[model samples]
Target: MSDLSATISPAVRLKGVSKTFGPIQALKPVNLDIAAGTIHALVGQNGAGKSTTLGILAGRISATTGDVEIGGARVDLGDPRRARAAGVVAIYQELTIVPALSAVANVFLGQPLSRGYLLSEGAMQSRFAELAGRLGVSIPTDAEARSLSVADQQTLEILRAIQANARIILFDEPTTALAQPEREALFKVMRDLRAEGHTLIYVSHNLDEVLGISDAITVFRNGSLIETRPTQAWTKAQLVTAMLGEEMGDIYHRRPASRLRDGEPAISVRDIALPGAIGEIGFSVRAGEILGVGGLVGSGRSSLLRALAGLEHRSSGQIEIAGREVAWPRTPRAARALGIALVPEDRKHQGLVLGMTAADNVTLPKLRAIARSGLIDNQLAAEVAADATRAFGFDPKRLFAPVGTLSGGNQQKVLLARWAFDRPKVLLVDEPTRGIDVGAKAEILDALRAFAEEGLAVIMVSSELEEICALADRVIVMSEGRQVDHIDASRAELSVHRILNSAFGVERHHHV
Candidate 1:
């Protein structure tokens, strides 16, 4: 490892930096320095100042007060162009690839080679080849970006940064969507970059990945810089405690098995299949049970949830409610009529109406129930929303506030409360509490448990194995499109490793 304490000037520096929007000071004053040619990491829960600090450095958002320095010299990276000019580039979570463009064209997108105001395609291809060679990555030069894998697209972004002569690069959640092998490939590229004397700043919520790639880690919380330590000096447990002021285990607790029921399952399904998504699979859940589905990124976890919700028209399945067989639900309306509700994956797009108020969103499913004389009762709607969301710790006074104005935590609460407003028999949630802070996570999980205790059968899908191990009374692991392993926490101990092993490929199934 390079000498972190060496007296050389830092490649990036933020001195007394702070950012605010109106009355909200999103980031408090922070002083941070990233040493030259080292992998530095920034970690925090949602609303933490880590993202704000990155924004100031990236020139995406200006800092309210303070100075930024590059190479010991003050520089004005006030916008994307200026930041690029200063040799700073950011690869956001959302890949910037244009689907129709080829790999060669994407590398030279904004700043392309031109000879006397005429595009120089030959020169661009030559430069692209050189950068690809430097990075030791093999991607078809003329391949359409949309056809490439996520890892290949990221390599194209890296080539773009290198074309701009960027010596400092920021990666935002770089490996969240990558599978195990793909993640290792990206890590190798990052290590190569560090060896070539480039400075890298990585931001991620996955603590294990953070520890593996970072030379040093900095923790941020509630708009303040909490602490910074060398990688070896910090444990995963320590990092969690610093980030949330609580141990990792404290944020998650196993649901008590005693709250479950002994009678027949509230809902059971057989032969769930959706084209190339999920293979024929089946499971059952009692009235007071939470069954979690765990798998890797494309392991059909969300697909299964969608199939059950009647969102996939091409999907075929056999479903039974309280041991009564019924025809498969092929439409959302049909599913709802049968007492099955789905809280979709993209809460902003597929789930809630952002322009609507919280109370308005909550009563959306059964709006007619709140109507009288051909007019909706605003007072009744507000009262109903307040009562529904109170169980999830949402502020009742904000019921009239627009859903867009609420935090991620509150928005999730709205989605859950809205779907469960009329009390469905089975609630299918995709990535419950995703993008929510660690602080709000427990409350959301507990609320789901409380609902299960109320005799509501819940089927949850989460990519995070720790959540599956903690919140699910039973877990069914999926690999590719097939069921791999089944575990009953009530009968056996559950661990993240066991779930991951099955997800990676063990191919064992337990009948419904």
Candidate 2:
């Protein structure tokens, strides 16, 4: 362990940390020492105790047996306020910004400046403008937080934490919601924060960011710290091996061209138009083929998926399945009836029921199929959930456990299982492996490949060029709500620069 205790005086420490919920031992006795003014990257597989550790640090929950020390002083952070008072700020993946409120209001939240008792809008706006400029985020103070793009919202949140003058910041998959350029800006902010002597505990699934940003890395496996190593001491392969306990070359198992059966188009879209932005957008997917939807954050990638899944009301468009023509589906159920399932990008909000059990979530989408005599067939639901758990390698003993209790990767698997269990002819999967561990990532990709091998069509949208390149047989690049170019995955060299170039065009590379 290189005597981490001797290397640097810890800004925060967790000694003999142990936490458990019900029958699940979420975290074991963990010892960690985070130094001052350094970005510490925490890496682990899904359900590997990453979030649990962060939760303890944030004071959202307490450890069963352990001591939390800040600045070499023990702190009883019984609540979030105490944690904040102790200079600990956590920016979780599940954003809590109020949609109806302005960015300034959301940022200042309950701690807004006040004269006597009334809120000071003028003071708040001035402070917000100054902070936004400092953060290099161009969010309008008066604009609703929800109206802003994901990148802007994330920036606002970071700025909020900084404004609080938090010395220790915990970023839980903060960049997962951001696009490339936005992520770059956030990285700059992290560097600046480090320069200002702020301690950072960066939690992310993107290994590239971890390699580029972190000074030291900590690996956790199944609720225990594997080891902590300096970033210079490891390579990508070594890190992957450490995280997965195996050698993983060729993370994506790419197949040859999809089986073209004369005239069968697995999925087809014609002249699809949104409320105001997109116009005459058209695309198609073939059996056993993976299509990549590449675009900027608001370039209508998610909207197009919603339109395909019949969740959005398309003004004028024709959708088809199995070469037979079909009009725009009215509801999600209607789309599912035609063997179309969508795994939304924001899985927590749009996909899974957080409070429901894993088994319940897996069976929620296909209740009609699993029901008999106007009642849900419990036995059938259990069988389906069990089969999905086995296939996805999710722990079936935790089937009755709440989806909220599961890690990001397992929750994602439950969502995938819900949709995949339907045996859809065409699957619309968006960001299948966002904010997850490497091991779970491989397993998810394997499931997708297996589905494709069964002649099921898959269309995936992701901001990660590596993931898109790895999974998709064909790539469709979108910008400004337009399909600019469709590249053959076989020809493209699967480089970050190439995919970024294709996504934003040659002119935009300078900005990127």
Candidate 3:
């Protein structure tokens, strides 16, 4: 063990911490002690009160009842300024960056360096450069936050927290959008911070990641702390059981071998290329097949899906649905008209309207089916929504509730239901199960398989290799905006190692 781990001290302590929002108790009274100079992991499903605990520590929300102590001193748990003063900061998955501002401006937001009413841009830029170098990340300080990638925005968030000299940094699902290489880089930075005697609270749903990076592991379920122990003392199965409150025999359900190779080609892309994003990509998916796209962040997997869905304008090549070539610059409406539907990766922004009711969202794409004399028939729409709710195993009672009010898994089901309603010939789904729990993941995968089994060609892009291996009949590995290799999932040698090797352009040696 390093010297930093040899001398450990309590950095943040919560006594009887609990929170309630009106009729719902988001968190139960809990106690926790985060150690200094160590990476402590908090694992739970969505809505498991992990966010609430972080909120209280960051002073973003007041605890309903309990006390919070930072660095051995009691601090105000409701004032963000007080929390910052006490060196506590939170980096959430949903970035808090100002899009219109420059990276440097965002780094010093709310705490600008000024000299008598005049801002000191040069000083801030110098400091930011130094910090960026120290963290081993390169980011343009002058560029607008909107122009940066999700990974860059997250890097900026960390830079801001480090600039504040945060003693206890709370990270909530920070790597949800990051690729394997980028995640490794972030972990390096985190280790450096730990070596410098800073405390880290990592909250995530990725069990493998928690196991790899955490010194101590804490599991939360239904707003209650289930267990907190050293990572070495727990197995992945134990963690999953603790998180879900039950043993998940097999989270993934593989289709029958007979069904794997049944249908004819339904969607074909011949040498399709997207400007500056994807190179010539050619593939075909049968009517009853799931083609999984796998790659690191910025590897063009998402772009390829978007291109096929007609969400992106292709510079060249051809897309054929049902053996008919589609025109270039295919718009989304055109794609829908051509019997294609896209369930985008960012479901919150692209897939559904948060403010709209679940019923309204379900019927938004096919309002004509529920219309009378060019006017929407409310009764018909409600029936359609109710049918979709039951079809997707969603609660009919929540049909009238805002789509955002539902859980992450339910929201995802709503998106899938919307596209499945039309019964499109080709379904383009990106990150279908991202940010959802194990149970929800199973439900979503089952639904997709059902769709494919019913002769709907499904193209799925997932960061989870296990998902790809289990659900896909074939996998296409992409890297640096091009298709690198393809793997047959039915092969005995199919593994994450083989997929990753193709993803990173590594040459694999196979015994003949």
lDDT of each: 0.84, 0.81, 0.83
RMSD to the hidden true structure, all candidates? 3.4, 3.5, 4.1
**Which sections of candidate 1 miss by over 4 Å?**
1-6, 246-248, 258-260, 352-414, 420-422, 433-437, 493-512
lDDT of 2 by residue, 1-512 (tens): 23344767889888888899978888999888888889999988887787889988998988898999999999987778899999999998777788899889888986788888888889988898887777566777889988988777877777788778789999998888776777898899888889889999988877888999999888888888888888888788888888887787777655565565334788888888878666657777888888877777777788788877888755568887877897688678888888889999888889988899999998887689888998998888889998977888888888888898788889888987886676788999988888878888888888887778788889888876777777777777767776766666666544556656756677332210
Could you tally the backbone clashes for each prediction? 1, 0, 0
lDDT tens digits, residue span 1-512, model 3: 11124356579888889998766687999888888888999887766777788888888889999888887788886788888899998988789999999999999988887888999998899999998988788998899999998888888888899889898899988888886777898899898888878899998778888899999988888889888888898899999899889988786656654274755578877787888999858888888888889888789988887877778755567777777776753678877887888999989988899999999999998889999999999999999988876766787877888897666778998998887777888899999888787767878888988888788888999888888888888888888887877777677656788888877768533211
| C-alpha RMSD between model 1 and the true structure | 3.4
Give lDDT tens digits, candidate 1, residues 131-209. Answer: 8888788998999999999999998999899888899999987885677788899999999999999999998877888
- Cα lDDT for residue 23, model 3? 61
C-alpha lDDT of residue 273 in model 1: 88
Off by over 4 Å in 2: 1-8, 115-140, 260-263, 489-501, 507-512
Candidate 2, residue 415: Cα displacement in angstroms equals: 1.9
**Please, what is the TM-score per model?**
0.88, 0.91, 0.87
Which candidate would rank higher by lDDT, 1 or 3? 1
Residue pairs in clash, model 2: none
